[model samples]
Target: TQLLEQSPQFLSIQEGENLTVYCNSSSVFSSLQWYRQEPGEGPVLLVTVVTGGEVKKLKRLTFQFGDARKDSSLHITAAQPGDTGLYLCAGIGNTGTASKLTFGTGTRLQVTL
Candidate 1:
């Protein structure tokens, strides 16, 4: 079981700008998921990628999984102040009934108008 790693611990950008966050791991996973979180609330699942080389887009957000299933990326377009929050990536380890997820360190984004 490999641990997920996220880059750019923090990011500050102005509204209308764009950014991409990355998640990497040494071990391959069955699936990868991205989430957004606020200070006082639980994380909200943004996207999930299960197949290699698969890409999913949600409005202005794009999520891509590496061909090897060991990495993923999240890209945001025209970021808005409401997009500022904690972003997390989680790799789902397939262990049957004992399945577990390895979460990335986390990336905090601040979008200013």
Candidate 2:
């Protein structure tokens, strides 16, 4: 079975702090997605990396797809209080298995002033 697990369920930091969130799995992912959600809204897509060993940078955040397509990582540099949110990772479900994806438990990031 394919499952994605995330580490550091909670993170509290001061402004300008840097952190890295990890996602691991035993099964390969056709595509991996990273999402962030605010207090009362749905998750917003941050980035989606499909190629193994690929990396994408969005201003202060960096996303990497594992060489094996079984893992991924998100690194934030100079984090701000506005960065506070719930981070999520998801992978496409296998056809005829489960139509929906298995997501990480989630990482609650709290950036304070």
Candidate 3:
């Protein structure tokens, strides 16, 4: 079993600021997914990175996959109060006929104006 860990369990920033969150694991993952969860709601998918060293951008947010597929990072530029939420990274691995998802400890972000 692979365990994914995220740094800075809590983050508080002002509006229009920039921040980066990290996710790391010792085992390699076939694919990695990032999600954001707001209060009283389930997490929403942000992005998925399948290729090593690949980077994907979503509006003001950027997602990067490590070259070894063992780590990933999410960067939010000009963060808004609406961006406040719980960020989670999930590692997906295929086990024969089934796929297993291991989620990180999670990072809670609060953006205040």
The candidate that achieves the highest lDDT relative to the unseen native structure = 3
Give lDDT for model 1: 0.94
Q: What lDDT tens digits, residue by residue, belong to model 3 across residues 1-113?
A: 79999988999999999999999999999999999999899989999999999999999999999999999999999999999999999999755556667999999999999
How close is each model in CA RMSD to the real structure? 0.9, 1.7, 0.9
> Which lDDT tens digits does candidate 2 get at residues 32-103?
999999988998989988899999999999999999999999999999999999999998754666647678
Which is the better candidate, 1 or 2, if ranked by lDDT? 1
Runs in model 2 with CA error above 4 Å? 94-99
Off by over 4 Å in 3: none
lDDT of each: 0.94, 0.91, 0.95
State, as a TM-score between 0 and 1, how close model 3 is to the true structure. Answer: 0.96
Answer with 1 or 2, whichever has the higher TM-score: 1
Candidate 2: clashing residue pairs, number: 0
- For each candidate, give its TM-score against the true structure: 0.96, 0.93, 0.96
Worst 10-residue lDDT window for candidate 1 reads 93-102
**What tens digits encode model 1's per-residue C-alpha lDDT throughout 16-86?**
99999999999899999999999999989999999999999999999999999999999999999999999
